[model samples]
Target: MADKEPEALKIRREIGLVGGVALVSGTMIGSGIFMSPQFVMAYVGSPGASLVIWALSGVVAMFAALSYTELGTVIPESGGDFIYILRIYGPCPAFFAAVTFILVVKPFSIAAMAISIAEYAMAPFYPGCQPPELAVKCTAAVMIVVVATVNILNVRLAVRVQVIFLVAKVIALTVIVIGGMVEISQSSAIIVENLNVENSFKGTHYSVSALGMGFFQGLWSYAGWYNLNHVTEELKRPEVNLPRALLIAIFLVTGLYLLVNVSYLTVMTPKELMSSNAVAVTWGNKVFGSWGWIMSVAAALSAFGSLNGTFFSGGRVCFVAAREGHMPDILSMAHVHRLTPSPALIFTTAVSLVVLIPGDFQSIVNFFSFTAWFFYAITLSGLLYLKIKKPELPRPYSVPIILPILVLIVAVFLVLAPIIDDPQIEYLYVTLFILSGAVVYVPFIHYKLCPGLLTKLTTFLQLFLEVAPAEKNL
Candidate 1:
């Protein structure tokens, strides 16, 4: 044999159906359920309309998740919408998506979840007052480092941690549900009044713009249903498990979210719920009495679980983008022995920490939806394109065309409602920043004008991280 081909490191298919369900549900359940119900109530102005919003949001999410199951099966890649957009719309649109996600969406989301974890974890210590900013940030930073380390060391271990946190989250929500049901059965004066059909529906707003924004807030709570698509290559069986996990995860989460919201209403009126910042904590205090700090700890653990899922998926986006030449080459590599995408994980952790430094939680949540749904619409449109234009392509899991069409309409509504009804200069600034990626992409990615300094940096990192370029072992 003259020269044997050098072996390239391959990604291990370590995620099974259970882990897949955990990733999707785990990420969707955290922080949002605890906080977003208030936003939903505020936007809709009544407990009843908010409940409708929550139900409609779940319907929207279920439709969107089913549509994504088809896309994941068709493309069957690691970057979720990024890879789908690249294949269908081409690299330019895909670059805008990757750029927006990397710069704004993923970083702010990770930062928000980490900060939520810190606030709740510290709540028990500082009763009747807010946690210190420094202590919260320090705790968030440590949580970020720990989560990143687990992901960098081994994908399996990180996934196991996700499963554990997911169990904790479900248990916490279940207890809240059971407590609320008990209260409803007792028909306490408060529960009866709040649940009164006439009283509950008293102040529903019918404004076109308000309804749109209300959906925006409610859908945020169901945000991560498509997360499993981000690491499709690592999934055990994309065709079988992708759709199965989506169905299981969305069905379970939708029921839990609705029940949890009803539970909140059973204890607090819409106005009261809207006035409170942490809905879960308030409900816990009412149900658990003075020992409510236990809820805080539970919330923190749940947030930590979502944090791990976000890190797992966000790194894969960067790694896959690098492999596609949208990012630096070094980011595409995996550790030689551990085979984890350590470089990309570290990069995402750093960006998230920087974002956490000045993270404004509410602002991040609103705009994160603005940027996210914009790309979601684009990606779902790709599915329609394939069905019509590229009809010959293989589709292991197919959905009716109407599903994506409906979801795309909802996505467009989500993207435009906020900016149109409430014009903000920041929206213009963010749009410009996303388009500016085209300027950078042309010279750096298209023309291959990577700087000489980057070459030396890549070399140094290659040795320092012990990572080599990856290939499909198949």
Candidate 2:
């Protein structure tokens, strides 16, 4: 195992229980809520099954969270799944994890969130007028730059902004939910014809394959439930608070999601919900008349909070990977004034900006989901490996062994469902792309065979990118 990280390499312990909750909830409650219902309903073809799929998604995520609670506190590192993989599986598999995660998964997610923010913010300004494509991308790029600047300058201020945006997100959901329930009571209109029957939305036989697809879609909406683990090193009383934050955040997000789905059902029929391009905006316009701009603002806040949290937690993945020698050592350095991993943060932001070039949010999400689930399943299975191999490792928190087993089953299904159903060649390309990381690792990292020319090039880049010496006590 590697030596303990020096205090200079450590992150500041400023995130408390509430901030931890905000990180988890705020990140998960993004554009997914506004956009995912249509896809989920399309896959399930029934209002009742759609809700069930959402609730089951929560249960699966909670199980995974419980398993991660043990790892997060016991390891208490900043890299989240990367740290766990390195500890149990060793540097090679961990190297692949870090590379795919930093290069593809996180950047794709940030771009998607930024685009969602742009769409919502632009929607309000242009009523019946389609904004130019250049304006949308420019707005999204500006949002990314602004959020990155906030994180680079002050980590604590970034988190405080996360909490504020999270509050606004909650208020928006509350308004939608309350408004839907009120409408339901006032006008007793049951929208779905065969609510729980097979193919209620479409008059066909029920298909388990379709339900699996719906599960995948719903799980994406719950994607960030484990985000707090990404910053465990920065949390106060992490051993106690990590699990608490996770449980609190997951339960809260789940409740809001179920209520929000029910609210949508109250006003819109299954066909209507499935046909909606912007579900929340459509719901708001139907319910609140011309005062529907609030929903658009709320969606913007959700995406904004998600983008900020992504930058906040995602930089640590690069930092810890650098500390372990998987990345250039310069990436491990933090700014002296803010105690933030400025180089890593800039790297994430720059990659995100580049990802915006191929700007289809659904396509990015599809590409990311397969690789993401692969790492998650591997990381969760590591718990069982560590338990059997190193039983004496002190774990401040532990879940029942069955929880990880069930989560693993669910995770495996999520990983393979899309490929089995659609047989997309792109999935093969994604797999090859992740495996391709080994090409670089075997030559440079394993054998320590970096040429002198490559070293000089990296050094030149590091000169401007990193602080010479990270602060020991900022």
Candidate 3:
């Protein structure tokens, strides 16, 4: 018999530690940080409480990062949480998660980022240019097309673009942080009265319940740390590098987040932060005076960097799911010359542009915040189930039992806090979208669209071991 050739894997493991960290950091530190403070201060009246909320979010994010590290190291594959869920739970739930990503979460997120990018970019040139809404929509559409072109032309080139943007953003933010700190030290800009314990917890106009709602809104800024895992298969030495990269990236971003917020708090009072829509730009004007336009340019840079990196990573989740036969086959198609998932990238960008058309930025963000956290809860539950059911699996990296338990509790709290504070009919709509995937899966699987039983079985076993409790002797 003639020798058979091994099946080709779509992923090429070219991403290294720096690239991996940039992927995570770039996605996590998006326009959320720039815009979230206003919403947060509106809820929690005190600068002190606002800082605490950001810090608490960081702690919770770190725990989730640890849990994911354990999972990524064991499976060491692409597809991220979708792969983990499909292996541990079954095809139906995995299908739903993947559907949610393609249909709602990824598209809205990318669109929102693009819109913010355009808003900041144009703010300087036009000065008071309140372009017609249609013009803004057109600009957003063009940006998406451009981003898609870059990725479709070459995957490595796309990654390089992401790295360069991220480096520039980080450097720019670092300078802002240093400049803000200098202002704090040199000027009597201290508004210590705003940090009073009683005042800190008070809401600007909303009730305590309303403050909780705002905290949920602020929490959205910190939501993208786990995005890097989606591209796990493309990462080199995923077993060791994936976990380390996540830890380092989350820690670095957390510090950056805290410093950025502190810089804002130092230069601008709580009341000022709560009132201004463009808090970062406002602070920049205060700190830099005539040179404040520089800050607006920096904000634009950060927004573009975030949009580019987030779409690049998020698009892979759809591409991989499609290749595995869980999503539409079109998403799996790669450019023959560029060696990238062109169709998927273009599809994601298209959906994002549609979202940008009718939706307000904050509304899109809130909707995504609600839906994305629901998925995170599901992802964490999958981790817990694997730990209990499969004890023998090797975990090169493991989260402490205490941390997962804590994460689960925090995840639940974060999810419910928003619902309790803001009772919305759309929340149920989001839930329905999540469940609708079950409808799509039955026909696909019945027709044997997926890999054969043995392949699935092996994948399941690997997943079970990856998330299971770490062996004592390892």
Candidate 4:
């Protein structure tokens, strides 16, 4: 028998450690750092508390990344959290998660990036020129088309572009860090105040409750480090590379985040950071004098780079889902010659453009954060379940039990804290959005896209194999 030609292994294993690192770093470093400080300042009154929030978020993110490393090494598949959940839980929940990603997470994320890009792009030429809503929509459309074009042409070419943009982003951030440090050294423009834990805790304005709420928001900004797992199949020697890539990426991004936040605080007082809409731009103006335009240009490049990286990685999740038969068949269809998932790519880009019309950047971030964390909580549960039920399964890389437990604790806090503090209408809107996936999942299952008998048989074998002793197993 012919070996079925390895199931059409079209994706080249050209992505090495550098590419893996780039994917993880590029995806995580996007608009979050640029926009999230304002939100963090609003939540936590003092710069010290804000820094603590980011530092704690880094630790939580590291735990989450370790948990994903265990799963990604075991599965070594492309669909990421979707695959992990499907293997441990069942098809129904996994299908819902996958649908939620396509319908909400991916599109909103892309739109958020595009909006950042458009805002940054216009800041220079138009100087106080805010484009009409329609113009912003057009800009988003153009961005989607350009990113899609680059990706479909070749994966290697696409990654090269990702590398260039990611490096540029790093440089832009470094510039800000240097600029801010210089400003701080020159004068006492920046304030450094220690939070009086006792009084701050007692005061309703600076209560522990408020800090906890702020911590959750800070955590959301640092959330996407695990997204690198979605491309595991394309990574060379994923067993070794996946875990290393995640750890390194998270560490680098965490340090960069701390430095960037410190820089923002160094140049602008907390009041200035909080009040200014364009915090980075304002910082640049303070430091560079007449050359503030240079910082605006850098911000624009940073946002564009982020937009490109986001679309490149986010689109892959949908493509992998479609290839697995959990989504529309057309999404699985690749370009015959180029070997790119053209249908999924186009579909994701189209949705991003549509979502760009309605809301500003923060709205999209809130929507994505709410849904992304919901799935993240589910993914962590799946890890714990598999660890208990399939303890014997080979895990070349395992998260220490304490870390996974900590991750679970933090994840639970992240989910509930948002609802407790904000309870913004958008929170309900996000919940409804996730639950809406069931609407499609039910009808699809009824039609037997996933047969009940097959699911039951798979579950039975899994349970039996897990529980059966070595002597009795044979």
Sorting all predicted structures by TM-score, with the top scorer first, yields 1, 2, 3, 4
Cα deviation in Å at residue 161, candidate 4?
1.0
Question: Candidate 4: where is the Cα deviation over 4 Å?
Answer: 1-9, 126-132, 192-217, 448-474
Which should have the higher TM-score, number 3 or number 4?
Answer: 3
Assess each prediction's global lDDT (C-alpha) against the native.
0.87, 0.83, 0.73, 0.72
Alpha-carbon shift of residue 386 in model 1 (angstroms): 0.6
What order do you get sorting by lDDT, best first? Answer: 1, 2, 3, 4
Off by over 4 Å in 2: 1-9, 126-132, 190-209, 451-474
Model 1 TM-score, 2 decimals: 0.97
Tens-digit per-residue lDDT, 213-321, candidate 4: 6765676556567766777767788888888888888899899988888788766766678776566777777788777767666766666666666676677778777
Q: Compose the digit string of candidate 1's lDDT tens values, residues 312-407.
A: 999999999898989998999999999998999999999999988976667778778888899999988999988889888888889999999999
Error of 3 at 303 (Å): 1.4
Best by TM-score: 1
Best by lDDT: 1
Error of 4 at 369 (Å): 0.9
List of clashing residue pairs for candidate 2: none
Evaluation by lDDT, superior candidate among 1 and 2: 1
Show the colliding residue pairs in model 1. Answer: none
